[model samples]
Target: MCARIASPCVGLCSTTLGDSVCRGCQRTDDEISEWMALPAEQRDSRMVELDGLRERVAGRFLRIDDEARLEAQLKRHRIRFRPEQPPLSRAVELLRVGRDRIRDLQCYGLVPLEGAVGLTAAELHERLSARLLEEASRRRRALQACTDSHC
Candidate 1:
């Protein structure tokens, strides 16, 4: 049997932002309120969706071959990070630093993808930042629309 899925609350609730969605956990206010009462199958499906969002929004930027390489890169760049943190959070910190310091990401095993190819480190960082922001904005809008329609 599969283990019971628990709430995705990261303790950084942002429901007060008036977006209906929690910026930290990505769950809408309604979902958050009803999480405990949700059926296992429904909860599992939501977890899958949240996981996909987490990966697309944050983990996609991490192109390292392994976690050790990522850790080394963080150390080499003097970027303070917690190994215990989620990969998404770590990737956010790693990508927030100046591109000059992390220009040669390949040296740290971060191979650029087709879209990132030929782009400078700064350009890649900007692209990733924009994508993250866009995703958040899209989610907020979606949640708002759902709320307006009472869905």
Candidate 2:
């Protein structure tokens, strides 16, 4: 009688922008590239390694339940010496920096920020759009200023 084959993975390999994984086995692109040359034992070992990595990734999410408590604590502490909000002129510069970081996150396919400091995918896109608008306005103002001086 033929033996039934064991399944390679769960449905957790949904994202594969930088990796390859079927339901049974998933690996980084570099690992997948060398998979054919690896001995079966080596492949098995890699699967074990991957399982550990997957668990770490899935378990590392920030706890949303604690967010409110943390915010409340900060508000109660009333940290002194808060600066006033910057004028509109400075918003562009701040947005530009934020957009750059967002782009880096998107390009890397993962935000490297610890905990909830990193923007979510939707938030990153929104920040980029806002930055683009800010940049356009800044350029327009600069051009108008230059024209006024020259004319």
Candidate 3:
């Protein structure tokens, strides 16, 4: 049996706030609305695309020292995450859900790197979230353009 594909919703959907791309999950507004009707394969494919972008952006700021430990921490703290998600990308979920509460990055099996240094957890989360939304929006527009042209 195929494993259930998890929705990326963080329960802080900015799409309701009129953003083209949700700052919470980074999904385009249309994707959010159509999520339930999307077939499993399409959901998985879209998840892979989202995970890839998350890892690309989050990797710029953090590194996973141990996936197992990170998973443990996430569960201990009750952070929502998909088991199928790349552990590195799960870092984004952690930052979003626990930004204000997280005190030490090392405890979560993450090492702050690059732009993450010298920033509070909230600050880091904001920067990462902003970048993710920006990229997702750009990608959505590109896809829309392609569709508009029948590419």
Candidate 4:
């Protein structure tokens, strides 16, 4: 069955048939009847039109690719105010946003970096986390030594 032309299924609702198109607002008996006769290109073109109609009736349909592309552009365009911040602070910021972005990239079918080629996002996160921990330990040790010397 075809989904409603006016509304896209957001993985919600149950149909009488496992795959029958929704019989609500947009798709009529005639549209469903002609669907099988349409050519592949025509069907694809129709699908795009149907998507817009669906969005009007339903909410926005956010494809992962759409979000990923937007996010990638945004990340590229972002201007960091404090470029001189210490590595720890930068690492913290990266951990907060970079981790989510990396996950989004992978979800959007972006090819992750090869091990020998370059650092993957996951690899970069691990390295940053380890480096931050090591730096913190060193700072603690230096502080302890300074306190002992003063005492």
Candidate 5:
């Protein structure tokens, strides 16, 4: 039987902080509240959107030669992924594979940040996730400030 899809919550819920989007999962407050009520197909669609957002936010740090190599690595590691997933999404998965398996990210075409070589996979994931949240929070604060000033 196919495994059930899982919610994207990373256990760092920050919607209570007034973020329109959850800094953890990157889901909008509406999306998070309605997730359980949504049908499977709708949930899948929302997951796709979330993946795209993640890809866009983290794209700058990923460097891929092509999708084929990425796909092959993901397959070799038995990681579930869409066939036509974005490069950054695939890269993020590679990062999630943990440090030992992905010791040499350059082999997968991911550009390592200076001094990042010493960090473990989980550490890198946390760092990237934090950066994504920080960026989203910055944008949200800017929008709120603009709205407040205009009103």
Candidate 6:
């Protein structure tokens, strides 16, 4: 779970169960374990990576109109989210916690974008989170490939 600090751990970490990608924050097991120990520069780099990933996936289905409203709703609902993350992440957090109950996206300052219509909040969250994970895995592989090639 996202803490008051810059860490993205959602507290419901599944990494301790031997999962590679944490079921809660979607971070890898290594990321969760090393986050606190990582240097500021490294943590900042990881935040940049997560922000980029959220933008790519969240932008596909949601748009933010009033970031303050999104922030308010997240706080009101006790949803965990990173202040360091992009505004779009607020909407993602809304879905993550209110998947079955979100009645009006407008209330959360979110506008349903392409591929979002015809899907319930639960469905959209499912798709978005799955896509986010897929994108992360793809980027990780690409990075590994480049590193392995000594590029």
Candidate achieving the largest TM-score: 3
Tens digit of lDDT per residue, candidate 6, span 20-88?
677566677767777888887898888787777777789999888889988998889888776677887
Error of 4 at 125 (Å): 1.2
Best by lDDT: 3
lDDT, candidate 1, 8-124, per-residue tens: 675657787675666656677878889988998898788667656655765555555566777777788776554445444555556656475666766665666667777777777
Give the Cα error of residue 117 in candidate 4, in Å: 4.7
Clashing pairs in 1: none
Per-residue lDDT of 6-111 in model 4, one digit per residue for the tens? 3222222223343233322123333355767767677666545543443222121111224344344435646131333232232233333455455443343233
What TM-score would each prediction reach against the true structure?
0.56, 0.27, 0.93, 0.32, 0.61, 0.84
Give per-candidate clash totals: 0, 3, 0, 3, 0, 3
Candidate 3 error regions (>4 Å): 1-5
lDDT of 1: 0.67
Worst 10 residues of 1 by lDDT: 81-90
* Model 2 segments more than 4 A misplaced: 1-26, 62-151
In candidate 2, how many Å is residue 42 off?
0.6
Better by TM-score, candidate 4 or 3? 3
Comparison by TM-score, 2 against 5, better one:
5
Tens-digit lDDT track of model 3 for 5-93:
57878798988988989988889999999998899889889999999999999988999998888999899988878768998788998
Task: Rank by lDDT, highest first.
Answer: 3, 6, 5, 1, 4, 2
Give per-model CA RMSD: 6.4, 21.3, 2.0, 24.5, 5.1, 3.3
Per-residue lDDT of 147 in model 5: 81
Reference-based lDDT, residue 148, model 5: 87
Ranking by TM-score: 3, 6, 5, 1, 4, 2
Task: Sum up the clashes in candidate 1.
Answer: 0
